[model samples]
Target: MTPLFIFLVLLTSQVLGGLNNGASSKNVGGRRQPTGGGGLDENIPVIEIRGEGAPMSSAQIRHLEEMDNGGPLDIKIEKTFVPAKCPQQAKRLDFVTFHYKVFTEDNKKVYQTYGTGPVTIQLGTGMIMPGLDKGLKGMCAEELRKVRVPYRMSRKSKSKVWKNIPNDENWLIFNIEMVEIKPYTPEIQFKFLDLNEDEQLTNKEVQDFQKKMKKEFGKTWKNEDIDNVTAAGYYIKYFDVNGDGIVTEVEWLKIMDRDEKLINDKKTKEKGRKRDPGIGWILDFDNDGIVSYKENDEAADRFDAGPTLLPMESKDEL
Candidate 1:
């Protein structure tokens, strides 16, 4: 019980306490062990603990890389083939014809235009998905590309689907080959129609154009052929905004602009609606948007009544 004994005891107790503290602070698996109170060490960094599951697939890995690059949901373009000379690359509002095969993330083919005819659509128009519209902007004829469209940029939900094309909350892959590009403008169309170079389209010229189109299409015309030929047939009746018999360049351009605006306005108003009536709704003779049972019956009767050639004056009066 002397002073020397008490000092030795105190030193031994202090040494034991230091050893325990050192053991508690030892690193385990590169992370600092928790202190004695069972709380995480403030110096230890946070670690994400993922549960065991199937290993990440290649597609998932690529998606992660995309996210790291800050473009996970952005459209991805991989040029498979680039022609040495791209004289005419597609631009906004240009008429482009292309063949494409659409696939899901697992490479399951959803839709395609291979055996069938290539699709022709005006770029920057909402005729196709937004991702595709932007992806095809700079493509040249014969050029091939692989485009990855994230779900966010594509049509989602069944209501937004178009033409029964597969549209779900998943990434869509497209293998596209540009077939042709045609510069389209109202002036170009008008010039082509005014073959005599008089800058005015007469009824005979319009009829001739329609005949030429019928010959060119050659018995392959479907009900959905809404092209220049159809427009020409209706020009004298509907597009000649004035009572003039011939359509001048100014009149043609003005009417064309007005019609385009009307079509665009209709599309905007019916953006999310199912069943766009298109031009076929004219059969809804009662002026109602929907085709009623009575209207269908009348149409059937007209079909059964045989084709009768009504006088042009009578037709105009009707």
Candidate 2:
């Protein structure tokens, strides 16, 4: 071949090689390979390879296997009825008024809230079983459902066994009907107590609110004729930071924040304090800054009997 012809042949070969290289560079192991710069290509989608890093130790593998086998099972829900006009649904931390009947796997009734009344509980508050709490989510008013609660999701205590509920590993079945859903928060509760839309909570307003809640929840005060002034003063004393008879929204929020901080601090500072004292303080229904022996006893009884889903009660009764 002539020298010019040889040069043309070499140039053609180089051009073909460059095209092949470009095609190969476009893809690597099913992922789009970045080009030119040592930076990810924003236009190309990146693929993630799970378990592609360091090999897990034998102990780690065993622990993961154990978790897979022993972790809580998801609650099974079977909807019985769903209303057409479902404007609202129960969600986490929302107050749900529900009527429930708990039964064993064998269909033996364990507990129920039919004859007495529907009970209200704040979802995700540890007031009910994890299964029940999760099952109640997304429930619209007047909706009926059958929930199967696994044994792992039920309440367990080494020191106490709930009455009628078997301590042995057994699942529960709940037939539930959602009555109402109230969106709840500390601010909402404060607004509820304010009552007058005056941006402040008065002692009388507090008293009236408590009375209204008691009646609404179908609970009676132990002392029917309990002194209203004294009862109201107790809550005012705890919430009213400026020694004023009325509690402003800011003051109420501040007290709540302080209580939360105190609880968190105690939890971090003291490892031995297993139970949150904030809950205990809340049990001081009289708001006297001390949980009385009677209060403790009542709480213990409630625990043994299974909580009634009533979040709060006066020191007098629930």
Candidate 3:
């Protein structure tokens, strides 16, 4: 072959070799692939359900397998369900004040993992975890439900106790029990049966009213009044509903009105007695006017004098 012709042939061979190498590299990088049956793109997830006689998608099969294996796969869960007997999806208030028991995919109780408290969020307000709010919105009184909520929607920042939750996508399972649904009443009306406080009462003034009610009137008072006043004082300091250092009697009364109803209601037993009082036991259930049974170790610790070993107290003394 001529020298020039040989050089041109070599150049053509090198160009074809380079092109073949580039195609092979693209295949190795997974940039190009053959797809059959209109399969979903690899980047997007596909869901399919299978039965004895039905069609199923790849994603659905994987979802079922993951669930069977206790949710081993990373998946987002979102669903909304109303109570079976929901009277009206819009006017669901009473059922909204339910106590929920959150659970995990492994069937572990979340309350045990995190210390216990009712996931109590007022229905309409944005106070609750979003998934919880959405789950409770349409529930009726005395309904039991299980709903799944994606971690993205859960109140992560609020739950300092759930310390080790993964920051990425997660799901929450809630087992909700609709215990009771009742009317919403204000605290002042329940307290004095009067909305108009003759004057703006201070914390001490509110306390004095209770003392007067007990002493002069010779009528017994529920210890909840004292606890409400104490809590309202703290709310005034922290929340400042009206931006006053002190919560006005009107403002305080309004809070009490909202909270007091909860205290008086029959369903209040769980929340009222279980609350941590910080000080000595402040609530006297059964209208007995004294701290008795239902008080736990945490409650007894409040009464020890001068840093005593709270656990050292005798059972009788406790």
Candidate 4:
């Protein structure tokens, strides 16, 4: 080919490639695209293979190419343990539990744990190794994978925990099996009940949500009258301390603090998951302690599960 023609063809191809990359399309989880803000939003999930200190660029991919040799961060899915349709996608702040084992280069087992109860951590929160964080970003619950992390990509600065590992190399090969994906925050149900855009919630709004749930689910879904000493009524009684009917931002945050306490509490109170603060606690009618659920106003205990502000059925993080 003539030099002029070859140059023109190469230039045209580069322009087309740029256009294609910038085209409007929503990724199933998230991906890179331009925005008026001119910065990649970290919350938007990316399918790209990632390294410890940076996004997977040409250099990092080359590093992986030399490290694991090929095959996209060495990911291999385990279909037997996964469901027919894995419902959720692990997101940035979603809490997750997974069983994992680390192996050395010669296939020697280095570290392992969480096979029974599973280790729980919030994704993207530095609770787990960065290599696993990057590799497992959009993975599904109950799915499994084998991933490799080279020394360069495994956060070398914090490399003090290698007593059993060889002194020469500091890499990890993980055999990971995801256990569960749990919600870290509420979604559409919260917005739908907001009634006013004041960024807070009220008892009546929750009651309306209950009515909508019944309409959407069925008559048998919830059964109680508005005026009764409903489970939800008691719940609002705890946080809506002033009894003014509306819950402000500060009050709602208090509920989250209580949840964190209930979750992290190590006492014997862990026998059964206390979905609600419980029955008698709410009757403190004096605004003395904990709270309860989103009732169709039923006999409280029968329907009183714990309180979920702007309550909605749990859903996958898609």
Q: TM-score winner between 2 and 4, please give it.
A: 2
* Cα lDDT tens digits for candidate 4, 1-318: 111211111223343344356655433234444532344433433243333443445455556566676443433333334556877888776777788787876788877775435566556544445566676777688787777776555542222222233323445677878888885563322343465767767666656644543443221222333333365565565556455766665555555455455545433321221222222223322122222233223334533543333322221210
Q: Rate the local accuracy (lDDT) of all candidates.
A: 0.59, 0.60, 0.41, 0.50
Candidate 3: RMSD to truth: 20.6
**Per-residue C-alpha lDDT of model 1 across residues 1-318, encoded as one tens digit per residue:** 111211111223343344356555645446564545335333433444444556666456657767787875778899999999988889876788999998898998888888877877656534577798789999999999999887767762232223445656367899999999998687866775676899987778866754543443221112333344443444454445455667677776665564455455542321221211222222333332344545444544443342232112221332
Ranking by TM-score, best first?
A: 1, 2, 4, 3
lDDT string, candidate 3, 1-318, tens digits: 111211111223343343444443323122453333232233332233333434565446546767786855432333334455655442322224455666665666665322354333335333345565666665566666777765545644323433433323355677766655544333322233222455443455445544443443222222333343553343334212444454444554444433335445644333233321111213332322233445332332322221221112222331
Clashing residue pairs in candidate 3 are: 46-59, 47-60, 48-57, 48-60, 151-170, 186-257, 187-256, 187-257, 187-258
lDDT of 2 at 206: 67
Q: For model 4, how big is the CA root-mean-square deviation?
A: 24.7
lDDT of 2: 0.60
The lDDT leader among the candidates is 2
Q: Write the per-residue lDDT of candidate 2 for residues 1-318, one digit (tens) a residue.
A: 111211111223343343345544555446565444334333443344343345666445545645786954567899999999999889876888998888887898888887877877667544556688799999999999999887667664321113444544456898999999998677766665566899987877867865654444322233344444555655566666666577787776776665655555442321221221212233443333344556544543333343222223233231
Error of 4 at 212 (Å): 41
